[model samples]
Target: MYYFFLDDKMLPVPPPKMEVKVNNKNKTVNLINEGEINIIKSPGLTEVSFEVMMPNEFYPFALYDNGVSNFITRLSGQQPTITYAKNYIDGFEKLKTGNNPFRLIIARFNQKFEYLSDTNMLVTLEEYNVGESSEYGFDWQVPMRFKQYRPYATKELEITTNENGEQVARVKQTRPTTKEVPKAYKVAANMTLWEACRRASGGSLDWKAVAELNGIRDNNVLKGTVLNLK
Candidate 1:
């Protein structure tokens, strides 16, 4: 069985002999651990925890951060756009099908900021008229400061297998589904902003108008389902 754990210092540790089930058939597999494996559990941890699980051998992976919905509330002016990435086995294109196992990891992060202002000009008065004086002028400056906060998440994934092992090198993916806003059948979730924009422009959804209506800058969604882009 493959056991993962962390030390008191919160460093990830992957133990040998992890238990894995292939096509619903249980078995123990050995890890060809590349660099390091660290896992740890802290006391009284309610909100977050670190984890590392190897779904298969000989696969290099990366993480993807799905933007949070409430992230827009933290900033004053606008919401940030969400970025996506594809996780593929290192040099996957060169490998032959059925000779490689497609292993990947996904994660999410948020932007952090620090407020800095050197001038109180925002609160100071600007003389629209040279002869007229005012106590204050309408001025505000909100610059986006950014950092990354890797948050904790748990993902429930369905594993697909090849009974004949004929297409082992091919990437397995899920079927697409349409997304709607709270059962209203408005916004589609599973697509990128670009895709969503195109679909919403068709009149069934007002893709361009929603931003002005909500006073929201970005289109990052927090819905539980992924939107299927048609």
Candidate 2:
């Protein structure tokens, strides 16, 4: 079984297919005396697209918040179709007006109801097309597109007087000061005191001696902190 969710709310019907593609942000550069070469960069925004059908009538296979009972759907003072459609509409409104990107999750399961792997990402809705189908008569065909969202801040340039008394423009970094990794074994999320010593001394130095050399009392450490190998 397959299920799609927007912001953790499951969609009533899964789209027949969803397309995911990555935008290429690499650059082609020509070096001196060297032919053209590709400079690989971080990936660009990802795109997700699919077409879904919103039935006007409740089909037996339709799922309403994991409940397929038509009786339960009618008790909510709306048709099963309206129930599902309104949910999607609400999601669209949030995507259009919300300040932050919402989570998109796709879950799959085996026929025996065993849990399978899932994919989750933060995305911003790019576009959606709502069309009425004459053949389906009152059913809605919605084509939706979403793009991966990543937040960033732009640096501003400042006009400053140089040592020679000449005015020059300098880019001032506005983000919080970040520690520079001067060596190979800078403490990080994945690098601990023990791990750093192993790499710094290559298993030749003991942990206690390395910790004492770096003045790391009681093994207290934090990310971006440096451990001295000598």
Q: How accurate is candidate 2 locally (lDDT)?
A: 0.66
In model 2, the runs with Cα more than 4 Å from the true position are: 66-87, 151-230
Measured by C-alpha RMSD in angstroms, how accurate is candidate 2? 16.0
Would you give me the overall lDDT of model 1?
Answer: 0.26
- Backbone clash total for model 1 is 20
**Top-scoring candidate (TM-score):** 2
lDDT on C-alpha atoms for all candidate structures? 0.26, 0.66
Worst 10 contiguous positions by lDDT, candidate 1: 119-128
**Candidate 1 lDDT for residue 75:** 38
**lDDT per residue (tens digit) for residues 58-124 in model 2:** 6766665532334544554445533557567767778767877887777666776444766678788
